[model samples]
Target: MFLRNQWYVAAWDYEVDRQPIARTICGEPIVLYRRFDRTLVAMRDACPHRLLPLSMGLKEGDNLRCRYHGLLLDSHGTALEMPHGERVTKHLCARTYPIVERHRFAWIWIGDAELADPALIPDFWPCSHPAWRFDGGYYHIKCDYRLAIDNLMDLTHETYVHQGSIGQPEILAAPIDTRVEDESVFVTRWMPDIDPPPFWRDALKRDGRVDRWQICRFIAPSSVIIDVGVAPVEAGATVENHDQGVRGFVIDALTPESATTSHYFWGMARNFDIDDAGFTARFKAQQGGVFLEDVDVLEAQQRSIEANPDMALRVFAIDVGGTRARQVIDKKLKAQGAAAS
Candidate 1:
């Protein structure tokens, strides 16, 4: 079951403009656009008149005019005019969702409007922080969002799936520590005084022994922020804090499109080389390629799971992080269901 009360990333800020874009979140079709003020407006994709997708309708100023019946709707999804008459029926309004643009993403609350609070949105501070440079792309993955989360929370797959990119023998040799703090799940691995992976070595721009770290944190309902980087051995970087060297936060926010599909918003925010535009572009492309590998593996895993209907997924020691994350999600879902009932 999907968590309806949480804020799901609808699209990147640039994705929504005068032209409305259609996105399905938690199985609800939504149309998102930016008004004249550049503020976001999210509403049901279907028109209130005849269920025509409003995303396909024409943009009349800040309003949307249904192409089929010519039903005009304001930014708030309120009917302003009818097809043949200027007088529109009162109370004929389409459902609008609470949307807020932050951290370069438009987040839509899919549940009770009154409960929609901007403060509840997931913290993606590095993306907006002035000291960091962040950029990435989106991926529509054909797999359950949880499977993507599972892949992220457990980095063992990196040794296989991303063998050519960021994977290293040190990562597999390092011991992982999994812990839960309230609703957050953390899986930390520190590879001390080892050769940095090619990705980190290039990011560091040096060729010396370094202490590498991968701290994967799961922030429910569906986001994993991985703190990764390396510092020269002399710099003495620790697992607690690694700002002494070039560090990056791998930002991943997954929004469920349906039971078997997800919207993957992935990026990296780095504290060092904040002014290097070339690095940002090149790295974004590289990161995109790496995640595409994940998408391929995840889609195959989903198909395998579907084919083996009688089989169950087996969890092992390395799966503690994902297991704990699933538990946290289950607990929140149970609470949400109990409250609704």
Candidate 2:
């Protein structure tokens, strides 16, 4: 089961233009599109009449026209018109979810509409900040959303998985600073004054080793904001000197589609090269490739878990971050369930 009463990424701002697109969030089918005012509208995809998905319809002006029976529905799911039917039922409206469009993403509330508060939405400031150039895409991940959360919380795997790009032996040797707060967790690992990976080395174009950091913040029910970058060894790589080197923020937002599938929205916001289109292209492509590696491993692990349900997982010192994340998620679920009861 998924935690409701939360805002989940429905789609990127540009993905839903005039045409209707269907996406399953939290295992519930819905259709998404933009109104004439460029506002996002999300509603239950199935028509109450014959259970035909409303997404199988056309966008007529500001409303959605159901193709099967010629039913026109507004953004609020109110039935506007019907084919040759004199009696237009007033209460025949499709279920609609609350939508908040900001930070270049469309967020939808999948729970009690009354409890859908915009303040509950997590903030990824760089996505909308002008000083950073942000680029990212969506991935259809065939694994549990929690798997991605765990993978992100414990990034030591990057040492082996990303050897050709961002990985280095220094990562595994570094000690992590893990902290838990109300509804959130932070897993930070700083590798001070080490040889830069090929990606950062080329980007920074520095002559010698540098100090790097991976400060990951995990928000409950699945969202992570990772601040990553490196500075010259002489610059100290601290908060004040971070601007002296190339740095970026990796923002991850996940929406669960099923017990074994999830929708992943991720991107990087870099402050160093705020206006370089070429760098943006390369950054997005290389970053996408890096995430593909993660997806491959996660899918394989999912298959293994399915094959051996009783298989026990061994935890180590490095797993403390992930273990704590899981505990926090479970606690949130328990509290939410009890409140609903």
Candidate 3:
């Protein structure tokens, strides 16, 4: 029930290197590696012979060799060599995924290679901008990808789940503004004349009243870009004031691993303090901690959902953005399903 003809973040550029990295996406096991020229390649994890994971094998030049048997497979998943034989079999070729590395993440197309256009990938350019410094980590969450998407679309949970680090009561009390343009859901909340959240207060040196903005945008399938910052409450939302304040982009790239698990690639991309190495490293570490707080709540919520699969949870007025986001994805899925049929 997931969108197949789309680009999903497979891993950060630095995550995979000489050794093959094994990952499961959309219920299909995949093995990722790099070529001599550093071009990233993704292929079926299971070897065609005996079904041993190719990841368990070693890299042989531009190809991968099966560990169980001396079978060498090329990047295109073609069997190039076999033990005690010098024959290339056509039917034993492994399935390869169309992949492209963009904005520091390797994006893989899950279905229809012909439809996998590089332009279809989401533009998270801010993460790779020269003026911005970005860092994040991946979390293997035990939940449906939609549940994680719902978590990002609704900011109300921050006050409760992330109370220790990035939460404040004013966030929940702030009036929400939801808008949908071109099938993208945008949820904005402006908390004026309130104490800054812990992260912003420390980063921006704002001890008193501050105006904070949590602008969350939900993309198709399951990706989110959260534009957040805080400025002096009296300065208003001017370009100059925002530049003087602390600003950052919370990039959440989500991909479904199975029917009940997800691969969450989250990062913090910021425009300020790029020259300060200590500041950059510390910020990245803190942001990772804050996200783990969310992990706790999301995993707990998933357990509850699994326990009562037949029971429907009640919706609240605050769920407008999350509900709308789900609707847009559902519509896309329906259209894709009909087209395929």
What is the lDDT, from 0 to 100, of the residue 271 in candidate 1? 95
Compute each candidate's TM-score over C-alphas.
0.98, 0.97, 0.96
Best candidate according to TM-score: 1
Candidate 2 lDDT tens digits, 1-341 = 89888899998887898788999999999999888888888999998777799999988898988888888888899988876775788688999999998787899998999999988888888899999889899999999998899889888999888889998889999989999999789998888888899988988976698988998888877889998999998876684347679889899998899999999999998887678899899889999999999999999999999999889677898888878888888998999889989
Most lDDT-accurate candidate: 1
Candidate 3 positional error at 57, Å:
1.1
User: Model 1, 1-341: lDDT tens per residue?
Assistant: 79977898999887888888999999999999889999999999999989999999999999999999899999988999998896878699989999998998989998999999899998999999999999989999999999999999988888888888799877788899988998899999999999877888887888989998899999989999999888999997788878998898999999999989999999999999889898789889999999999999999999999999999999999889989999998999999899889
RMSD of each: 1.0, 1.3, 1.7
Cα lDDT of all candidates, in order? 0.91, 0.88, 0.87
User: What is candidate 2's CA lDDT for residue 269?
Assistant: 89
TM-score of 3: 0.96
Residue pairs clashing in model 1 are none
Q: Judging by lDDT, tell me the better candidate of 1 and 2.
A: 1
Where model 2 places Cα greater than 4 Å from the true spot, the runs are 239-241
